[model samples]
Target chain A: MKRKKLRRAEDLFFTWVMRACLMTAAVVLGLILFVIFWRGIGALSWEMVSQPPSGGFYLSQGGGGVFHAIVGSLYLAAGATLLASLIAVPVVLYIHVYSPNGRLANNLRLALDIMWGIPSIVYGAFGFALMIYLGMRASLLAGIITLALVVLPILARTFDEVVSMAPRHLHETTFSLGSTRLEFLGVLLRQTVPGLLTAVLLAFGRGIGDAASVLFTAGFTNNMPEGLLRPVASLPLAVFFQLGTPFPEVQARAYASALILTVIILTISILAQLSISRLGRHVIR
Target chain B: MEATPDTTIRPLPAKKIAASRLSRWRWFKDAGARTMLGATAVIICLLIVVITAALTARSWPILSAYPLAELLTGQVWQPMRGLFGFAPFIAGSVAVTLVAMAFAVVPAVFSGMYLAEYTSSRTRSALKPLIDLLVGIPSVVYGLWGVLFIVPLVRDHIGPLSDRTLGQFFPFFARTNPSGYGLLAAGFVLAVMVFPLIVAVTEEVLRSIPREMRETLLALGATRWETTRCIMRRAALSGTLAAIVLGFSRAFGETLAVMMLIGNTPRIPSSLFDAAYSLPALIANNYGEIMSVPLYESALMGAALLLLIVVLGFNVMARLVIMRLTKRS
Candidate 1:
């Protein structure tokens, strides 16, 4: 009887601990989101998003904004998403069509999984090495290439999963229609278009928010992105640099930048949701 | 030409000629798609090899010049004088990663269990998105939160509290840092960053387990916790381990949040409060100086290579384990 009672007590204790862990996670998320909003909302303003940083803005002479960083992040992520999708789509389609479960296909999947696991900082280092070998500088073009490397695995893997989840019957139907393999590919893609969009947005969000990979490759500048070959500022790096300043106001601006970034991500998630739900109708499902 | 008796070779009709031309074009297009798309797949596969090669080529100079053991174990990190010992960075990275994993794994597992077993489908669905939000938050923003909140908590509370109590028992808690930016802060920030990943994967794993196991255990008069500890946990062991490994790899490679709070001192930390340098942080911080020094770039690249190899090793192991678990399920 005593042993049974002790077991019950132990179980009760374990249950409570589990509950506590759940509460802790919820509280932590709440705290983080709360802190960001509370500190950030005050510093956010139209001017903050409209103009580039003035001279000595780091010193809190700040009549300027992180406009360049915002725009540059968009430009960088947009270009990278385009490049990654161009490559990822073709590769994913090929994997699905040609050799769905062959050694090459399996290895390719593993390769992408490994790539997805690589730290952005290592990607940054690798990109820097490649840039040096190519005699390239830390310009927008270089940053785009590096960021593409970072997001490619993500795009490819997510799209691959989407493509794989596609009902096999679609393939049969396409073949039964006496369509060529390319036409079958077209039909498969049409069915998974929403998923592909979701994958692209996911990659774009990841690319835009990443800091380590772009820290060296995307050299910062106060100017607006003048050309693809010129150095460009990014939101993550902007927040990092701004917070590094000794001035409180400059640091506050960092919070504002964080808020902007968070808002952008939130928007992307919203779009992903909308895309999946509203776009599900046309999908073969 | 002979199939249709009436349509025997009557000067090769125009329709037949056009049909043959179109079929040839279609065949060419099919082959073109096959080869081109196949090449893309091959290129994607070669990407990892290329990354490894590029990193090795870049870091070869430092590796060839310095003895391997000395470079890895040497303590001093004076790059100006060409002393690029990676001992401190390695220790710092390992320590911080360990700390992060320790803090993260239990809570993550317990929460994952709760979500997977106890919660209704409705609650699970509602909370899963919230957990994903944690994963989606940018590391730099996490860094910002650490700087504003966690660093100060460490400086004022955790630092002094540990120094008074646990400090007496363990040297690891003995030091009281004034700046409050150290391994502990970095680990805490990274813990928050990796928490969601572990939870998501663990929950996924647990959910994939056969529901019959739980029903049988409960029907045998087992409490929910008993069922969880014995049957559910046992079944989900490999998956949970994979989750932990995945989380560990994620924490190990985290750069931005850690960089913000680790104080960037180039020495191995003996205590949680002592400032430390990490390999990723080293690469991130030393970008500007790489151009000035001769082997500085190579040294940093070497650090990157070390980090990459470690993360890659963990990921491959985790992948294999996950594959095993999935196969069993």
Candidate 2:
């Protein structure tokens, strides 16, 4: 009876410690959200979204905004997502439809898994080296290409999972009907459309939020991205550069940019989750 | 061409029959789609190869100019003086990663255990999304938080407290400058950044344990704590180790946040309060300025190559361990 009581007490202690760990994680996340919103809310405005920073805006007081950065980020992320999707979709389709259980398919998946774990900084270095060798300057093109590389593996892997979850009988039936491989791929695509969108959105979120990968390649500019060869500013870099200044207003703007970035990411994540559930309902098994 | 009566009836024309056969063959033989996707797959594989080759070719100048030992082991990293040693940054990276792991592991493991063993399905579902969101938060935002909140708190409170309490005996906490930007602050931010990843991996590891094992322990009159401590913990040990290794790789390659908080000084830090540089930080900080100098770009590329090799090695080992665990489970 005494030993039983001691065990009960130990169990209670273990449970409480675990609860505290959960509480700590929740509190840290809450603190981050609270701090960012509190610091940035006052500086967010329509004018801040519409106007670009004037000269000496980092140091001097002025009514300026991150319009350039916002536009540049959108363009860069959109371009990267498009490029990644163009390559990743075909690869995933090939794996799922053409060679579902082949050695080549498995090896490809493994390679992508490794690529997924690579650090963004290495991607940046690779992009930078390639640019120098090709005599290309820091421009929107360079940033897009680098970001595409970063997002490609993620998009491909996610899409592969979605495609694999498709009912096997669906493929067998289509093949039994004497459908061409392309037509069969078309059917699979229809089944996984929601999942494909979620993968693209997730990739877009990653591409937009990343800073280290594009820091050297993008080469920040004050103006919006005018052409493929022109330099572009992004939200992450904007926050980095603005916060480095010694001015209060600029720092506030940096927080606002971070707030913007956070909201975008949050929205994408929520959408992705919703689509996953929606797609789950479509799964036969 | 047969003009007999049965042939003249011509139930089906030879050309029409040939067309149907060709269509049937088209269903099974899709050379166009096959080649297209096969080429796309090849391109995907080539990306990794190209990146490795590019990094190697760019780093060749530095590798040839300076011996590998000298580049890796030399203490000073004075670029202007043509000294390109990576020892300080490498040490800094390892130290910061170790400190970050130290802060993150306990809480992560506990939380993971709670979610896996103690919590209801509803509670687990509710907390899982929150953790996922935390993982999605940008590193730049984390860096901003570090600069604004963590740095000040460390400088004003933790640094002074450490100095007063541990200064007499421990040299690691003895020299506190109160600058707030050093190894400790960087580690704290990194811990926060990597917390979600560790939690996710650990929870997965714990969840993969067979229910029969837990039931056996409970049936033996073991309390919940005893069952977890004696049986489940041992079962999931390898997975938890793999989780820690994966998180360490993440912390090691982290850049912007560490750069903001680590003070970016090129020296081996003797104390947690001292400033230090990391490999990624070094590359990010110097890439713009090094373009004007001759072997400087090569040296930076060399540092990047070293980082890539180290991270890849860790990732491969972690992958193998996880694969083994999954196979066993």
Candidate 3:
């Protein structure tokens, strides 16, 4: 009876410890999101969204909005997404249909895997060097190219997987019926358009959220983007530079900005996941 | 021709010629697509060459002027005056990473093990998505959080500890005001930023352990903890280690959060309260500010090259470990 009681006590203790671990994990995730949202929403306002950031807080001097940063972030993300998709889609399609043989396909896949493994900072360095060499000083075009390079591997890999998993019989039948390569591509692309869009959205989310690579190449400028070749501010960069200072209201604004950025990223990720599952369900059915 | 045998043949001008022309064109298009595919395969490889060339070209001036030892071993990083030793950045990067990893690994791995080995299916479903949300949160957001909530707490509490301990002797510790923008704060924020990744990867590895082993251990009258320790944990050690390494790499490469939180002061961390810098942070801060045809430019590029090499080295090592494990498994 004594031994059994001891064993039971030990088991109960371990179980409770394990339960606490689980609880902590859940709480950690919850707290991170909650803190961001709580602090961020408190500082957010229409005026804050409409004007460019200036020197003082809203409660005191009516601090400016993140309008320029938002626009710049959107422009850069869109530009990078467009460039990456333009490069990745054709490459992914070719790898899927034309390069079914071992050497070409395997090499491409390995290149992408390596690229994915490469750090974002390296991409920034390369971008800075390349841009400087080309006589472009911290320009938006440089930022776009840098982000596009970093995202290319991710887009290609995801698109390639989706396109390959697409109905093979459709391709075989089209080929046997003497349809041209372009026709086959058109049909396959139409079928996989949603999946490809999801890939682009994921890349856009990553690009917009990324700050380090953009920091060197994008160079935080407060002015609105005059053109593709000019420097511009971004949401991530603004939060990064502003949050480190000693002011309370500035910090609050930073929280709001951070909250906005996180929301955008989370929304895109959730949407991507939903589309992936939807695609999976379609394939299964 | 066989179809024509069934009825009166319709007259056509050069039917064989048209078929041949069509086949030739189809072949050409196929060939073109194949060529495009091959070109895509070469693109990344080509990028590797381009980057290497650009970096080496930029570093030529500094390398020609200074010996390799001075560049690696010198203490100061005065790029404007042609001094280009990145030891401070290197030390700062290492110290911050070490502290962050120390804070992150234990809690993350324990949580992962608990989730994988202890939790029920319903619980998993409810909690897993929440954990993923942590991973999806942007680094900039984490930076903001650190700046606002965490920095103040550190400043008010932990910063005083350093002041109390080393108040008389060390000037650096005396300067330990509760700014929350220092190495410790950055390290904690990095720990938070990387926590989800470590937990998720470690959990997946732990979950992959076969149930039969655990069942057998349990049937032998071992408790759940005993079963996990003797069977599941032992089996997943290498995988857990790999997850740790991967997490380390993520923390190492994290630039935005660390740069923002870590007071970008290029000095060795004399105390936990002291501020420090990191390689990626330094690059991000100075790369834009440096001008062309200057020693600062070369030094920055050189540091960047070194950082790139280090990150690449870690990735290669991680991949190698993964490959060996795969072969063994």
- Give candidate 3's whole-model lDDT: 0.76
Error in Å for residue A6 of model 2:
3.0
lDDT per residue as tens, model 2, A1-285: 998888899999999998998898888888888888888788888876887887776884776888899889888899999999998997799877777667678768767876877889999999999999899999999999999998988899889978988887787777666566676788888888988998998899889988889998988988867999999999999999989898888889899988988888889899888988776676555
Per-residue lDDT tens digits for candidate 3, residues A1-285, read: 898778778877877776776577677667777888988899888876788866654343556878788888988889998998988898777766655645667667656755766668878888988887788888788999999988888788878877877876777666666666555776778788878977887788878887777888887776778887789899988776666566777767778788778878888888877876675554421
True contacts kept of each: 0.70, 0.65, 0.48
What ranking of all candidate models by lDDT puts the best one first?
1, 2, 3
Model 1 chain B — which ten-residue stretch has the worst lDDT? B7-16
lDDT of 3 by residue, B199-307 (tens): 8767877766777878899999888777777754578787778777777877877888888788888887877667898988887777656775378778777877777
Candidate 1 overall lDDT versus native: 0.87
Cα-based lDDT at residue A175, candidate 1:
65
TM-score of 1: 0.93
Residue pairs in candidate 1 whose N, alpha carbon or C atoms collide under 3 angstroms: none
Alpha carbon lDDT of residue A133, candidate 1? 91
Q: Which ten residues in a row have the lowest lDDT in candidate 2 chain B?
A: B6-15
CAPRI docking class of candidate 2: medium
The whole-model lDDT of each prediction reads 0.87, 0.85, 0.76
